[model samples]
Target: MYEGAVQDLIDELGRLPGVGPKSAQRIAFHLLQAEPADAQRLADAITRVKATVRFCARCFNVSEAEECRICRDPRRDGRVLCVVEEARDVVAIERTREYRGRYHVLGGAISPIDGIGPDDLHVRDLVRRLDDEPVDELIIATNPNVEGEATASYLSRLFAPLGVRITRLASGLPVGGDLDYADEVTLGRAFAGRRDVRG
Candidate 1:
């Protein structure tokens, strides 16, 4: 337990996702011990991000402008669109540097338990993009979990009639991971996604 304002700070910090009571306590104490300038800098950065960052009107990615850098880039392949559940996923894919296409942020995956559904997502925006843009393929990059699978399936069915080729990111046992430790679903997917060896 802490004093009035310090306890309030801990309570507020605990509200952030992934931050628990202990972590919030640690962070609050750390901030208290930190130089006043450092605390002020953190506050300023948070304020700046909230004031400037907005979702890209085109692809819904977090951006300071109307369109994100990827959407604005002329070098990116506009014909291929990768759909992901969140803006963080876009960063993940970008880190790979293998994909050279644009992205669509779905906002979230379908989770009935969480009261999120297809309508709750940005599916309509995606359909509109398909019509407005010259997209040749849609790569579903949703996570391989239950919610992600449902979202992917719903998207596949919805976009099937639109004539845009739909594909999913492959999932399987990770590199250097032993087969014995792999889950059945992942192992099955690995076998299902196997390719013929070539010289």
Candidate 2:
């Protein structure tokens, strides 16, 4: 029912992931009715993030510099690498404070139906990092879904001959739930119960 810029804003917002048309309309109206300063701040924040953030050169996580803070931290264990499907999963694991290792953000999981393959992700970078670093173990923290499983399996096979230990996060995660959404307790348990991937 809205016109011009207001409807345009709703349409743009609706295109974002997880935002339905109704939710987008609600948000557009909320921004329109809110103080100009408040809306401006949100817009500025989004703009700044898009402009300033770059992927970490080492781990592929979002960062303002060539390397992310996690990759630069001397305290994190270089001998252990936690492989995740996305950068958001790095934040989720960090919140638990239970892991003191480094991470590799794969960017996306293998989805044959969607035409995403092993080469489409950061798997090559991960393998290169292993060749350069002294990583003793690789913890696969991909989600517990079909695509995630395929990605994990692919990685396991790729890394098998390298002699590094490969482990997968335990099940009992909410079925079809993204790793980014799992609660700290459940996520921690999965980490603790990680099992070796035997080839």
Winner by TM-score: 1
Which tens-of-lDDT digit does each residue in 2-99 have in candidate 1? 88999999999999999999999999999999999999999999999999999999999999999999999999999999999999999999999999
What TM-score goes with each of the models? Answer: 0.97, 0.86
Question: What does candidate 1 score in Cα RMSD to the true structure?
Answer: 0.9
Sequence-dependent TM-score of model 2: 0.86
Candidate 1: list runs displaced more than 4 Å: none
lDDT of each: 0.96, 0.94
Candidate 2 weakest ten by summed lDDT:
168-177
Model 1, CA-based lDDT:
0.96
Q: Model 1 misses residue 175 by how many Å?
A: 1.7
Question: Which residue pairs show backbone clashes in model 1?
Answer: none
